[model samples]
Target: MAKRFFIKTFGCQMNVNDSEKMAGLLRDMGYEKAQTPEEADIVIVNTCSVRAKPDNKAYSFIGNLKRLKKRRPDLVVAVAGCVPQKEKEQILRFPHVDLVFGTFNFVKLPQLLERVKREGRVVEILNRKIPEEEKLPLVDSYLENPFIAYVTVQRGCNRFCTYCIVPFTRGRERSVAPHLVVEEVKRLAERGVKEVHLLGQNVDFYGYQGTDLADLLYMVSEVEGVERVRFTTSHPAGFSERIARAIRDIPKVCPYVHLPPQSGSNRVLERMNRGYTREEYIEKVQMLREFVPNVALSGDFIVGFPGETEEDFEQTLSLVEECVFDQAFVFEYSPRPFTKAATFKDDVPKEVKNRRLQTLQELVKKQALERNLERVGKVEEVLIEGFSPKGSELYGRTADNKPVAVEGSEELIGKTVEVEITQASPFFLKGKPVTTGVRSKR
Candidate 1:
């Protein structure tokens, strides 16, 4: 009988892709996936450490798994991802955890599982080096809709920003070969996937050692049946004027960029070791806007950092007003172990950070709503992802990556249809298919 397994993933889209690959490997080894953890012979928790919430959630989930382990003594419980990489010793202290795999050693899960089952003991496999691509499992995305998929072309980061643990946990930057990336995209496109999002810690740093992101973008756009190409987590420092020009010229690439400008205050940015000054970041954004006029820009912001003064907070607000990003993912700074910032005094008070975060969020939300409102009555070609979570309507994303909910049949899934926007909100758009019953007769 084939053993059953379950994997619960946390954190970013990259973690989701990692879970997909892990699941594929298990499936190949005759392990069927269980809908829930309670029924599985093996349970995996792919975790994150980017923020405090997910870290707490991962630990709580692990604690709950202890009951399952007690119920089924033979059940195998493994912890993977950033948390495992960061807290290997602490996680291994838990008796129920049989395998502790880290970010780099995820591809070794199958063999590690065998060892755990035979030994009736625990195994912790977390190597810091980037694993060869061939060793990683190429998992099928068992997504609800097969229309859109995430493909990671690069992994790890070379830049060690003061507040980030990714460099220590994920290692130096490395990219999958351009030929392999295009081949993967082509295969996904042939599988009826309408869109592919290229992922990386610093995606713009892709091909830095060899193959540049622009070259990869140009090649991926040429893949047959690939209608839209997107990449994320671009670093402001790595983005070049030439790359901005390529983005403007690439037809198949989406005109939406998620570049993280962690702090707007140049002093705080310097403290964070972000590698770009406020003026430089502004110039980069300006260059980008010059090339891609209608481009949608989003960014990440850390509101309060160690030793941040009132003046620093004001500077952040001033930068926000200056940039007027389409959307911004604002966060209050939280110290992580091993990062340079963690060693600092962490002088900014918690209440002050909370207030600053709220203020920034309100401004950004207001700006985002205003931006969305401008798109009202505009016709957009959206690749129908499938039914909305609420179930009565269909939903899809525009070329610029805005989500739109529409009334349509399931057949509309995977097809790019013109949607006439009727209503717009900060987060989503309400639209109807342009070619429906009345238009079909024509």
Candidate 2:
């Protein structure tokens, strides 16, 4: 029987893409996918260390694998992703963990696994810089949805925000050549991918050999079969006017941007080493609105950082009211090892953090509902993704990336259609197809 493998992925889009790549590599090696870890001959856990919850979850899950390893001694258990990258020695201390690899050592998986079988335990963490010539070919795993694809335009991050661990885990920033990025998108388009989201720690900062993000956006938009393009996790400091103009001008580019402003107080912002003041972030938002009038803006916020006062929390609330963001990912601060902020006393009380998070979330929900309410009675072009979680309704996303549930057949899964918004909720919209058998433009 062919070896069966199971992978459980945790955290961001980048991790999801990494899991897909690993699955593809295993399939090429004549291994079949197992639906559950219990049934698999090899089980891999891809972890995240971005927050306390995900870190705790990874440890708990790996601990449970101890029994599975005992029941099936031949099982190859491995740990990969950011957590392993940061805690290499610590992770190997787990008795069941047979193989360990880091974020940059994904290409060395096969060799490491073979070495682990012979040596009983193996860890391969390479510190070598990712060269332009060694870029991995875009993995196409049809088994894991192919209609929507993520193309990594850049790797790593240069800006070391005090609270972030991306720099230590993923290393310094490196951009894939613009020509190669365009080629990847073209190949995805040929494979029936209607939408592509360019992935990077700071997407707007993408540039190499004088080709800026704006130039790359224009190139990708001109691809023949790609209907919509989006990018994520942009830093406010790196957002440029040229990139804003590109969003306004490119028909294929969606008018939504996820700019993260960790805090709204200048004092807190400076403490976090965000490189931009609260006033500058507001100015950037204004500039984006001026360029794209109908643009939907989303952002991230961290509450209860060390030394944050009631006044600082108030300023964050005030900024949210002023921005009236369509969506916001709010979090309570948690210190990570090796970050500058980790050295500071975690002065904020637990009760205070919980209260502040609740307040911010309530305001965000109200603003999101208000924004979605405006779409009522309007026709939106939606890319039909798939069925909703319960499979009782079909769902898709608008150009601004709002989820819209509509009445449609399974055949419309990969096609773009117009939906007339009838009702609005805080998280998504309800709609019906405007016309049948008429596909929207690319």
User: Candidate 2 regions off by >4 Å?
Assistant: 131-143
Q: How many clashes (backbone atoms < 3 Å, residues ≥3 apart in a chain or on different chains) does model 1 have?
A: 1
Considering every candidate listed, which one attains the maximal lDDT?
2
lDDT of 1 by residue, 185-219 (tens): 77777777768899999999888446799988999
- Least well predicted 10-residue stretch by lDDT in candidate 1: 433-442
Scored by Cα lDDT, where does model 1 land?
Answer: 0.83
Model 2: lDDT of residue 309: 100
Clashes per candidate, residues 3 or more apart or on different chains: 1, 0
- Model 1: which residue pairs collide? 207-211
Q: What's the lDDT for candidate 2?
A: 0.86
Indicate the TM-score of model 2: 0.96
